[model samples]
Target: MSQLGTLEDLPIGFRQGLTATNLVPLWPNLRGALPHGIPTRRTRPLLWRYSEIRPQLMEAGRLTPIEKAERRVLVLANPGLGLENMQATPSIYIGMQLILPGETAPNHKHSPSAVRFVVEGAGGFTVVEGERCPMEPGDLILTPSGLWHEHGHTGSEPVVWMDALDLPLVFALEASYCTEGEPQNIRNEPDASQTRYRRSGLVPWSGWMRPPTNYPLVRFPWRDVKAALADLASVTPRGEAVRLAYVNPETGRECLPILGFSAVQLRPGESLALPRHSASAVMNIVDGAGVAEIDGVQLQFEQFDTIAVPTHARVRIENSSSTKPAHLFVVDDAPMQRKLGFYEILANEALPPI
Candidate 1:
């Protein structure tokens, strides 16, 4: 007999033959494999106000010690993209880490990369490898993948920082691993790595002390960054914001291997034009109040408020005050996406370049 004209036309016994051989036909599922329209993601946009969560973090510090909890971080899970019911985002993992005075978050290293933006307090520091960098409000620190690091606060009050990681992607790929380092970081010298790697327009000579892929700088001091932003704000025309991307001093690459970091400033009465990209971004309001319209959703943000913009979502930023400027710190997985050939951008068709 001639072959059945189509899969559905085949007799029940013939259909069972295909399934039993582990060779099911693909012709019936071609449409789902190649859809006609752009795909939509399950992840959704959201915002978190630090003021509302600060008390909970404080309460956590009182309940758990660094040794018991290992690290006191409250994960900022994206409600829409909770994988395996763990409440993790699709691409990134964010949390507010707290370290009370006289406490030290133990040393450990993981396959996922991490970065921290200081929220408040002083005398708190991060020890990466051997060099210790004191973290103050506004400072940014890197903890690259597989790097030994720990946190401690010697100040009177608790030190809190917004922590961002690429662990969600790591978990998605099933490449997650963690290991404990020595009780203390190998090196205790303060600012040694910063002085060695972050000097102006210079890189330290290295015979055999470098890794295949790692950011050389341990800390990007807020003072110098703020000063440069202020200078740019003055010269860049009115109603324009100054944006700076943090790069590696050695190769001028991104600050982290998996993520991108940037600082943005919106001058008084400045409004950034709407633009969209393939990568989603989580923005922390460093100072000043502003309104960010993302995908037709309006978010009025104040200091310490965090707003998440989903992939390819249109965004426009506006500074609310006519006399004061707004500063924002942003983190995104653009580096990984770009490296994977899935990154695109529509950079400011309405306004001047940032």
Candidate 2:
């Protein structure tokens, strides 16, 4: 019995004199008092929100400049990060890294498709398969699944970015593989002509240049996507008609063959339903404000907010305001679905619990 229980057996007037905090309500007031008496607020705990965790992320977001200098691979959240927590997800794993310039994070490669978004950086470059591309804020780079890649900093200051990969997905499929990558120039940043330079712009498909490889030649900048949406303001972003599907520039399809990726624009207070109905998708709110509802459970999303929409979960994405548009990055195996003749069916109605 709690101290309150001992208190309950005291004179009735004795309990009345105590403040609500002094007493705990054990059962619903709907029911009469129990043999154990009322439960106290002391026994009930409060809920903590993610916003409450921001300070932790900020404080925990520290990484050494790079001691290995040439053979460096410093991960931001180390012994305290609890990376094993990601295994529970089993489908997607996301890791954030804060890399500084003048420090090369040793050249290494694994059998996984990795995507890097410049969370905070300037004039950084990533050499993938011998191709070096200029990196800037909001630029996207890919170290294709099972390909050799290395990183080198060119600017004066530090560069921090988010590293997202299909590690969990691969692990779930039991296709996980890793190894020390072959070193081409562990200490060298070769010329661009000798390697592939991702155009980050549209390429006119010339049937003669050779069939398109799974990887494409376009990098959509955050600013450009916003501008494109501004030009298309007349259209509503709700139905599939308003949704934009990203495709390979050469093939004009998703970024990669099996790994599909697209970007969408949402005006504040505006919303768009999940267009590719049955395919699973992971969306990162690049910019603007919004709420993502899956079967009536609403999730408020802002810039850099990521949400995973599992296969066949009826969902609707909405913006909370109107001044700014919500730009989002969507990744799914849409093309692969089509190739497998498994284009998902659109869930016309989002079902909510009674």
Candidates in order have lDDT scores of 0.80, 0.55
- Per-prediction TM-score: 0.86, 0.67
Predict model 1's lDDT versus the native: 0.80
- Per-residue lDDT of 1-354 in model 1, one digit per residue for the tens? 233245776688978998999877665655456544444666677778888879999999889877788888887777787634333346778889999889988888999998999989988999888778889899999988888898887899889999988887887789989998776635645574456755556666671256524666869888777878998988998654598889877777887878899999888888886447788889999999978887667888899988887887778888888898888999988999889997888553453322
| Clash tally, candidates in order | 1, 12
Clashes of 1: 1
Tell how far residue 266 is off in model 1, in angstroms.
Answer: 1.0
CA deviation > 4 Å runs, candidate 2: 1-90, 154-158, 182-207, 216-218, 234-242, 339-341, 350-354
lDDT of 2 by residue, 1-354 (tens): 423345446676755765444974443342344433221211111111224333444444343335434332223221222444452122344455545556566566776677776655676777776666666666667777766676667787656555656665566677877666555543365433223333435343453277767664434454555555566666653443244555555655566545566667666556566553656556666667667776455777766655656555567777777676667776665555687796767646743321
Candidate 1: worst-modelled 10 consecutive residues by lDDT: 345-354
Error of 2 at 35 (Å): 44
